[model samples]
Target: MITLDFDGFKSEIETPSEDLRIYNFWATWCAPCIHEMPYFESVVKDTKGTNLVFVSLDDDRRPERVKAFVEKKGFSSPIWLLSEKEQKDWKQKLKEDWSGAIPATLFVTAAGKRHFHTGQISEEKLKELIETYK
Candidate 1:
């Protein structure tokens, strides 16, 4: 797991690649985010050739808590703590429709296709989204 500030995250999202990428925005305190994590984990285990990145929206002052939570949950996917303070600015950069909501997701493929979803995502729906790129 790695910690990335706003610039690093932007750079990551901008760099295009042939592989499919899924950026899941979550936090330790977000119940919906925690609840849907298992579903994401299950999909990650079964799927191949896809990049699953868990971007934690926890407070910058308490990154240890975020780290502890991820370790406690046994999350296998690469996790990153968002270190940026200007949430509004970065949120717009990620997506104009995004309302800085937790449990949000961004799916990008090598073909330049991008999909953004807000709120808790079900396993079936996640699979369906992934299937689109497959």
Candidate 2:
């Protein structure tokens, strides 16, 4: 898994691209986040021309926990750990109306349109969103 500070995260999300990118913000300790992961993974496996990034909000000091969790889950998508301790400002930068919630998702389409969802998304909804954006 790669670790990124706020600036790096910003650059990643801001850079122009032609493929749809799905960024899922989560943590090892978030139950809802964990619950929604399998659906995300399933979508990642089944979807084409779409990129999914699992962005860990776990503490940077204890990335080992996140790493271990990922290893146990056998996640195939790229995982990222946020290095910033405070998310107040950066969370807003990610999405203005974001409430800093777990299981949040930010979708950026090939055409550069962006959509942000603040809660757990059902598997069907995930697929629908991908189809809508892709």
TM-score against truth, every candidate: 0.92, 0.94
Q: Kindly report which residue pairs in candidate 2 clash with one another.
A: none
Candidate 1's displacement at residue 8, Å, is 0.9
C-alpha lDDT values of all predictions: 0.85, 0.89
Model 1 alpha-carbon miss at residue 71, Å: 0.9
| Residue 122 displacement in candidate 1 (angstroms) | 0.4
What pairs collide in candidate 1? none
Give all candidate RMSDs, comma-separated: 1.3, 1.2
Q: Which stretches of candidate 2 lie above 4 Å from their native place?
A: none
How would you encode candidate 2's per-residue C-alpha lDDT over 11-114 as one tens digit per residue?
98889887899999999989999999988988867888888899999888988899899999988889999986757678887777777888899999987789
Could you give candidate 1's per-residue lDDT for residues 1-134 as a string of tens digits? 67787789988977988778899999888999999998898896788867888998888778789889888989888888887576668898789877898899999887767888999999999998888875
Best by lDDT: 2
What does the lDDT read for residue 66 in candidate 2?
91
